[model samples]
Target: MPLLRMFRVFVCCVLALTAMGVCGQNSLANQTIKWDDYTYKFLSTGQSAQVFDSAGKVVGTILSMNGDLQMIPLPGTDEEKLKKSFADWKAFYARSHSAGGSSSAGATATPAASSSNGGPAVPCPSTYGVSYFDGTAWKTMMLAVQMPKEKSVSLSQGFKDMGKNPLNPRAGETMIYRYKDPAAPLTTGPNPSFCVSISANFNPSQIMIGTVDIKKDHREIEQAVSSRDSWLPPKRVQQVDIKRVSETVVVVTPKTPLPPGQYVLGGPPMVGIYDFGVRASQ
Candidate 1:
C-alpha cells in the first residue's frame, strides 16, 4: 500500500509540470532577467512609440504588440507567440517608416530613426562624412572646406558671382583657394554607384548632396542649401531617392544622373560636407 501511494504521488507531480508547460504562466512583463551583475526587464511592448518631425513634434503609430514573446526562454516556450511578435513588428516598421514616423521601434525601445533637417543625419560612417563605391569597394570621400566665408554665395568662371560667405575664412588672413587639380581628391565615373544607407538608426531623408560650384581654378560647395535664393546658383542641390533593399539598410541615389563635375555630400555649416569629382570615363 505504501508503494502504491508513492507511485501515485510521482504521477501527480509529472502532471502538474506538464500543465505548466502548456500554459504561459510567465510573461515578459512579469519576468526578471539577470545577466552578469545587471538585472534587466522587458520594458517595451514591441510596438511603435512616438514619432517626431524635423522640429521633434509628435506624429503617428505603427504595429502593436499582440502577445508576450516569452522575452527569452525555452523548454516548451511559446515559440509561436514569439514569431507573431516579430512579424507584427516587421510589418509595422515598414508602414511607420513610409509615414515618416521617425521614433518607431520594432521590437523594443530601439528607434528606427530618420532626419527631416537639411543635412546628412546618420549612417555615413561618420556624422558628417560620406563614401563612394569604386566597383571594388566603398571608399571614404574627403570633406571639402571653402576659404571660410560668412553668408551663402555663388562664384563661377565669370557668371555674375552671387553673394559669398562673408564670414572670416579663418583667424588668418582671408584667402581664396586655387586648384590645378580637381578640388575633390576622389573622382567617379559620371554615373557613379554611390548610395545612401538607411539602416535602422540611419536617417537618409534629411540628406543633401550638390553639384560642386566650379570656379576659374577652385571648387566650392556653398550653394547646397534649401533656401534656393535667387541670388545663389541653380542646380547646385540634388534631391535624393531612397529605396529599401533590406530590413535595416536602404540605398540612396541621386534622383538625377550626375553631370561631369565636382559634387558635395553633407551640409549645415558647422558639420561640413564630403566631396568628390565626377568625370568622363576614359
Candidate 2:
C-alpha cells in the first residue's frame, strides 16, 4: 500500500514538473537524476533521493525541491500539505521555466488511494528513483546498508529510528544512516529493473546487484565486513545491463533471468543491508 501511495506521489511530481519544464541541465547525467543542486542540496548531484530533514520528513520531492523540501508533505503523507506544496511549487516552477502556469501541479488527481490488490487501479510509476514493477504496479525497493560490528554486519527489514541502534551494535557502529526494509523484495520478474539516482562522482555503469548468501536458519542476513573498504557495498556479484535513461536515472536489469534464490541490491545504501528470496519460479 505504501508502495502504491509512493508511486502516485512520484508520478504526480513528474507530471507537474515535466509539464512546467526543467530548470537546469547537468553536463553528465544518465539514468535517473531527477532533482539537482539547483533544486536542493540533499536532493542534488550524487545525493540520495531518500533525503530527510531533521523533522524525520522526506524532503526530496518536486513539490518542495525549488523551495524548501521540508515544507512539502512526505511522499505519501498529508494531502493538504501536498496541496499547499503544489501551490508553492507553481511559483518556483514558473521561475524555472520562465513561463506562466497555474498550480495544476499540486492539483494532481491522485488515483484511488491505497487499495487491496483487488481494489482501484494504481498509477504507473515514473522512471525515477530505485524501483521495479512487481506485477501490480511499479513497486519501489528499499535501500539497505549495514550495521557493522567488529567482524560482521547485520541487516534488518524496515529498520526504523535509524540512529538508535540496539545497545550492542558492538557499541561501536557508525551513525551515518537512513531507513530501509530488511528485504529488498521482488514478487515477480526474474530480470528485475532498478532505477539508480546516481550522484556526481558515481558512474552509472557501476550498478550493484548481487546474489545474497542465505543461511540455513534464514532468520536474517549478515556478512563479515572485515574485508570491506567502507562497510561493504551490497555484496555485488551479478553483472547487470546498466542503461542510462533520461538524465541520471540508470536502469539496471539482470543480464539473464535469475533463478530462485536470495539476493541483494545496493551500491550506496549507507546504513543497513537487507536480502530477498526469489522463489517466483517455484
Candidate 3:
C-alpha cells in the first residue's frame, strides 16, 4: 500500500509541474505583446494624458492634439512581436493592394511608388506625431519607425546626419517635435513639409523613410513645430526631408525658398500638420 501511495504522489507531482509549465507559457505570451514605458500630455488643454503599456514601460503617450503618440524602443523581446506585426502589416498591405480588401466594391489599394528623386508622387501620411482632435476629444495616432535597408544609401546618410549608431539605431528611441513658431500653421497638401524635432530620440545612428500608402491621404494633415537647422543645413531650409528615426516616427524638413514672396517668418514644427509618428498596435 505504501508503494502505491508513493506512485500516486509521483503522478500528482508530475501534474503539478505540467500545470505550472502551462501557466508559465501563458504568462510569457502575454508578455510578448507588452511594450515599453512612456508618457504624453496635451499642451493646449493643460490636461494629463492617459498612457498605456503592457510591459509596464510606457511605449507611447496619449495626447489631446494627437490621437496616440508612440516612440520606438530597442527590440529586446518585443522583436518577435515587431516581426509578427510587420508581417501582419505586410499581409494586410498586400490584400489591400490587390483590391481584395475594402469597404467599397471596385475599390483598389495602390502601393506608394516614389519617383526617382525618392519622393512620393503624392503627399506622404502624417506618420510622425500625428494628432486627431474631435470637438472635445483628442487622440494621437500610434506608429512604428521602420528603419531603412542596411545597405541602402538613405540609411547610411540618415545615420551620418543624425549621429545614430548604425548597428542598433532602433533602440529606445523617441522623438518630440518642437515648433519654432508655436502659432504657425503646418503645411497640408500634396507633399506637405515641416521641420525636425529637437527632443531626445529624434535622431539615431541610422534611418530610412518607408513606403507610405497613398490610399489614406488624410495622414498628411498632422504637424508639429521645429527649427530647420537642427538636422540639415539652412540652405536645405524648410525642404521637407523625410528620415526614419526607428520604426515610430519619420523626421521631415520642409523645402526652402518659401512660396515666392513667402519668408520663413518663424521656426517650423519638428512634426508639422499631418506628421504621423510610428507605433505598433496589439
TM-score of 1: 0.43
Candidate 2: what lDDT? 0.42
In what order do the candidates fall by lDDT, top score first? 1, 2, 3
Off by over 4 Å in 2: 1-129, 145-186, 216-236, 269-274, 280-282
TM-score, every prediction: 0.43, 0.39, 0.18
Error of 3 at 142 (Å): 32
Order of the predicted models by TM-score, top scorer first:
1, 2, 3
Cα RMSD, model 1 = 13.2
Q: Residues 1-282, candidate 2: write the lDDT tens digits.
A: 999999999999988876443332221112132221112222343212343433445554442344332333355665564444334333334443343422222112222112112221333244335665465565666544444323322344113213454443333222223223433444445656554555444555445666654444232334332223533334436766654332344445677777776676666542123344566663
**Residue-level lDDT tens digits of model 3 in 87-206:** 333343334434345321111222232222333423223333443232232234333222221212233345454554446554233232232222223222233232222334343222
Candidate 2, residue 124: CA error in Å?
8.6
Give stretches of model 1 more than 4 Å off: 1-44, 47-128, 148-183, 191-206, 221-234, 242-252
Tell me each candidate's RMSD, in Å, in order.
13.2, 18.7, 20.8
- Give the alpha carbon lDDT tens digit for every residue of 38-141 in model 1: 12333353222332223343322223335323223233534454444334344444454444553322222222222222223222232224456565555666
